[model samples]
Target: MKTSISLNQENLSLIPSDVITPSYDRDKVTTSIVHIGVGNFHRSHEAFYTNELMERYGILDCGICGVGLLDYDRRIYNILKDQDGLYTLITKELDGSLTARVIGSIVEYIFAPENPIAVIEKMANPAIKIISLTITEGGYNLNEATGEFDFSNPVIVEDMKNPMSPKTVFGYLSQALKLRMQRGIPGCTIQSCDNIQGNGDVAKKALTEYIEKTEPELLPWIEENVSFPNSMVDRITPVTVAADIERLKTEFQVEDQWPVVCEPFKQWVIEDQFITGRPEWEKVGAQFVENVIPFENMKLRLLNAGHTVLGMLGALHGYKTIDEAAHDKDFQFFLKAFMNEEVTPTLGNLGNIDLNKYKKSLIDRFQNIYIKDLISRICLESSAKIPIFLLPTIKAQLQGKANITRATFIIAAWCKYNDGVDENGKSYAIEDALSNELIRAAALSHENPIRFLQIRSIFGDLIDNKTFVDAFLSSLKMIREKKIKECVAEINSRLS
Candidate 1:
């Protein structure tokens, strides 16, 4: 667990021969994109692509200036600031090979809470074209019931009151855009790299709603100049554990405090609607298309939903990681059935993607033993993820009156998961934004199974549908009585 070299600009040469280091001149790299929410996914996907552009073709204009908005972001802020914004990205291929690369796309970083005005000024800079974001699914601050930006959020309200010293991403963006408009600067693109379906549209809705409440006059200029392009971003970047850091130090001889480890596979399907210029990401395997919804649905339903199926059942069964559950035949069969029977039919068209092959690839990705994607990580934000990834398939299946057995079982398992006790009676905390309410509702489900769905914020009107209620009640009963394994086997057999 000892390290020989610290990762920084000067130590690039001392990095191991096998690991790829950025060859571009860092001094010449210009910050054109200011990315918010600089997390593991952003490091692995967008920053990796941008770094490739700089490393492969010497395209330095698209260098990223990473920004962290939340209080928890202080860790990343300090790590990147200390490490000179350099971190090792270790990619584990399916064949059990590792590729280490030093991603240098993030040339500078700004922690917004330290100096809000400085962050706003950087975004207002004329050279900064795209103020990109990887804020998580719930980070948009949308009201779950109404499907609009939640202006009632405390931080948002604070941002509205004190615009210059903003609290949220929207506040900084609105203030920055106001500065740009005042100085006669052209409006830049506001791109979202989150996993949400129609991420750009969601971003536009949230930001525009914020502007409408604060500065209504900025709307017309934003409409004319700014572009919000929807995108589908995929990569299996697990949260860095203590083991990951030690591995980098022992095997790679690099002491990186906040290195990212992910699966080798990555895909980005973007709508070709950037108002300002974008990086030539297509040169590095990113697909720029006319519409990204089909692809988004394909990825979300198949990959994200599939992960939920595994995570929920896996947690109940005491399986620690995604690979553990994925390796189980029962879990694999259940997931494959859910994807083929429930999800695939709902996806209208995916351009050139073969649905069957995509499903198989997803199964393969889930079973990657090297990835170590934790069940806890997969289940972290279920309240936000389920609506976007899993619920639409359920809704579509209901409309078609198709088999909802597997999907129903997953939901049942989620309810049991929120009960805070696994099948073996071992207790674990529900790591969700709505954990308190979810736990209360789930606890009430013991008397009346419909109580869980009555949480209108999460379930919406799904509780009102008699057919869904019946199936959910049945599934929840089976989960409590028969447990996850037997329940999964029964569902798989029933679907088969």
Candidate 2:
């Protein structure tokens, strides 16, 4: 049986930008969500739902005004403009399910840094009820150890000195809040859509601190007016590929170059907090919880953390995609083993996670052939990711009798990956915030495991519990000598 959805004029072309045109009828769709860093994940997770909202309910004013950080984003800004804020989202299923949907939620995209005042004007618009971000972990400009804004960063320093020519998200946020305060527009809710614990709270704290440190004048108004709703967003969207185009054409009867694909499983757990209220997102299968802590912590620590571990090890082990890595039963076994043995104990409060159900879903998502997320994308910001995602488990393991061996191998593999060269002696670009420093440190760590783990920011204070450090160091040393695959096998043996 042939399965293809006929495309409307917008989605009928090969180039994604060919179909991008501003929806004339979007006057009904006001900017309710102001999103920072208009990346693929944001498009897949949050904006995808917003599109669902409008489609299901005929609700208007559920549009997103995308805010890019720099003038360099002019390229994307222009492309999205051509589409008139419309694009295609191609969702793939593990059990061979698929959907080709055209999303028209991003009403406009602006390179905010190019015109700071205009960006502020857009943000300060009373119609904008929520400010959501997918700036990623590293994009938060936080110090790895401190979990606070790193004003010491030159970009932040520049932002502090000249808020208008801002280089940091904090500066733009505070400046926008100031503008909002001046106009008496209620400051919008700040939503964090990244894979982080206390995402909204983190954004709130970071932005508040930025204001306190740099623009004390805006702090009072911000404290009273803003809402920061914690949330958990999950999906596995890889960068677009050429095959996706042919697939789009064959499946959706549309030609889109940048169609996004992901495993059909999608979940959004958001706190029911919004200024001027929110879309009845629950109408579109979003879970509005009283507290998003358990969900956020669970997903961030287990799922995202696992994705990273698998991604790095998979690459080092010469696998290109997550599914390929997952197909290696040995690799998949290590993943499940670590999650169960080491990570679970640390997360006692994960109520009703339904581990078996989750595992089945996880395996399916990872093994979905089409949702080909690259290992390197997941490898960024190990400095930020490891502390939240893995360290707590490591700490708990140290406090208990769980084998630290598997955990040790992961750390070792990370150190090895950070050493920054592929098996062919070709250098893989390590595009992390602290890439150079990490490469330098990882290189030295191979020589002195103890000294390497001592890096306070990357490993944090928890690792100093000598017991964990010793175990971790031993594992790292062994892995460096034995290689990841062999070390993983050894670690699994210890666990078994």
Candidate 3:
């Protein structure tokens, strides 16, 4: 019977030697990067890379000061703060092995709701050269249809009204950038680690728009000094559950409050256009490219769109996890076909990447037995995800006259999924920012099959395209009449 060692700075020596602990003195590591939206993905991806860079190269200036902007983030803030901003990163390998490492890159965390000024001031610090973000797709506050920053959002509205005490990411950023400008501190690079395509451009647009409205005086300074570098960040970090915490204690004798669990696969491709100096993360498995668009498209169209395919189809078929869906022969066939036929065609130049190898790796990654990425997690906020991840491929396919069978079927499947009941009659809540609208439209799909597509904000003019509308209706009809697995098999057969 072994007692668990609490994972903290003081207990580093007491933790099992098998677990790789940070060798660098964390106290000496200054927070040079102020990261907003400290979530599982940030910890597993960005912090993990920074930790490796520090551990191997002895570069300690890139330590992260994580700021939580949302009320829900208080949980992670409390957990990481209690654990001294130290957490275990457990990578579930393809061979069913787990590699556990303690990440110390996050030396400090500020829950913005508790003290917004602290977060703003921390960002204003001249030493903090790069302000990175992992605020998810929805966090940018972009209107999915207009492709612009939504100013009408209540938080953005309130943020404009009261700039000093900010609510949204844009508000905090505006306030901080203003402080930096007033103090004559050279502007830092605002790097976006979110999944949106052209993430950096989106960040700059959102922030500039917010600032132009709130503090028009700061535009010239921002134009002269600020930089927003686009980046493509890939790592499948599943939401941590209690069992993950218990497993850390039981197997490794390390008790961690929130351990990040992800697949062994990780990749980051960044544009080397930072105004302020950045970490030499290139030495630590991150790719620095002149243009991150090719990488971004390849990842987003294939990996992300692939996840949505499995997630929607799997949910409709009553599968709970990605591994469960990927393990199924039909689901695997459907996903592979969708990737090869629908998505690969839309991808731009990937340079040296082998499409066959990449697609195969994606299938293998999705089937990782240990990751168990929840379909629900993948399915969350499909309203936002579909527009960014899937629809582009659809539009491109529509334009190119390429394979739209599986893509159309996916949209149909998404409609059927929004019915809020699986084929097995199990009721599951449809998780989306526009859940109510989706459900309402989906309910009308029975009478008018195109009702789901009528959400012009999402589907856009695809409803008017005869090829798209006809295929969509055909798929929806088949979905209503046949089992989801049968529908997937049919599409797989047709595509093959």
Candidate 2 per-residue C-alpha lDDT over 137-218 given as tens digits, one digit per residue, 9 for 90 to 100:
7777777767777878888888878877776678778888888898888778888998778888888888887788877888
TM-score of 3: 0.98
Q: After superposition, how far is residue 302 of candidate 3 from its true place, in Å?
A: 0.8
Angstrom error at residue 4, model 1: 1.4
**What TM-score does candidate 1 get on C-alpha atoms?**
0.97
What stretches of model 1 exceed 4 Å from their correct place? 1-3
By TM-score rank, best first, the candidates go: 3, 1, 2
Worst 10 residues of 2 by lDDT: 15-24
Clash count per candidate = 0, 8, 0
Clashing residue pairs in candidate 2 are: 20-82, 20-83, 20-84, 21-82, 21-83, 21-84, 22-84, 30-61
Residue lDDT tens for model 3, 111-220 = 99999999999999999999999887888887878878898899888988888898899889888989999998999999999888899998999889888888999999
lDDT of each: 0.90, 0.76, 0.90
